[model samples]
Target: MSTGFIILALITIAGAIGAMNCGRLVHCALSLVASFAGLAGIYLQLNVWFVGVAQILVYVGAVAILIVVALLVTRNAESDRQNEGSKGWIAGGSVALLVFILLAGALSNTAVTGAATLAPDSSVETIGRRMMTLYVIPLEALALLLTAALLGAVVIALGGPKPGRASK
Candidate 1:
């Protein structure tokens, strides 16, 4: 592996660990962003330009920022953390180990078949055209869905009726 790939992998692993172990929601969100960015860099290094850019744009740009903003707006992150006292680490670890063993056994029994490769036909333009023409409705629906979700988050954060407002 290249030095750049090794660096990116290390960053990704560190960020993932921080995201999972950090006590504060804001710190965890920031660590998740670091992990997303490092994965994007690794994708770019692997020459998958579209996926890398999409990772950076959609994950790092949109999702992580939205999470941070939502956490800030709610302003109850610490209180929730206090409420969630014990995290049952032993049970979680045991389940994870069980799943890993099952997956390893399954993979060990699977046969690898080598197939002839086909020429590359997917370009950025083709993907863009497909998105604009074939999948526009789904795309617009997803945008509307995300907008509704954002509005819902804001409403929840506001804690219902305000002091000067009347409820119907």
Candidate 2:
């Protein structure tokens, strides 16, 4: 409804489309960063500064960089050859239509609901405390996931066999 909301929505949609349709893997990753930044902007418009900051810091900063690094390490700068396989256009168009229908339905049925809201400072501090205390398990799991991704990247970058003639 607001100007900020309209701008953010355009940014989100454009960035998402760019990310999905970009030919270069690095360009796609950069588009993802733009999408995350737009999401953060939306959060800011909603008065959730903590969430906005966290989105920029975690997703735009760390996740985007990780994706770029992974793409580089895997040598996927160009589109994959496998993507040229048969009927890809049909499959991709079907999936896109389904997603568009779902989003349209959701938007049509949405209603604005109001509830008691916390002060941003208290909300952020509470979240931090809860994450470190009650939600420590999930945090640890996230760390483990990052560790696994790093290891996988390392393996991909280093584990390939040397090129040579095969024994007959």
Best by lDDT: 1
Q: How accurate is candidate 1 locally (lDDT)?
A: 0.86
TM-score of each: 0.70, 0.67
RMSD per model, one decimal: 3.9, 5.1
Which ranges of candidate 1 are over 4 A from the true structure? 1-7, 73-87, 112-122, 159-168
- Model 1 poorest ten-residue lDDT run: 77-86
lDDT by residue (1-168, candidate 2, tens digit) is 689899999999899999987767778888888889999999888888888999999999988988887787788434442355448868998998999999999988988585657644647788899999999999999999999989998889676666663332
lDDT of each: 0.86, 0.84
lDDT per residue as tens, model 1, 3-119: 998999999999998998787778899999999999999988766788889999999999998898888877863554654445676778799899999999999999968564553
Mark the regions of model 2 whose C-alpha exceeds 4 Å error after superposition.
Answer: 76-86, 106-122, 129-168
Pairs of colliding residues, candidate 1: none
Error of 2 at 2 (Å): 0.5
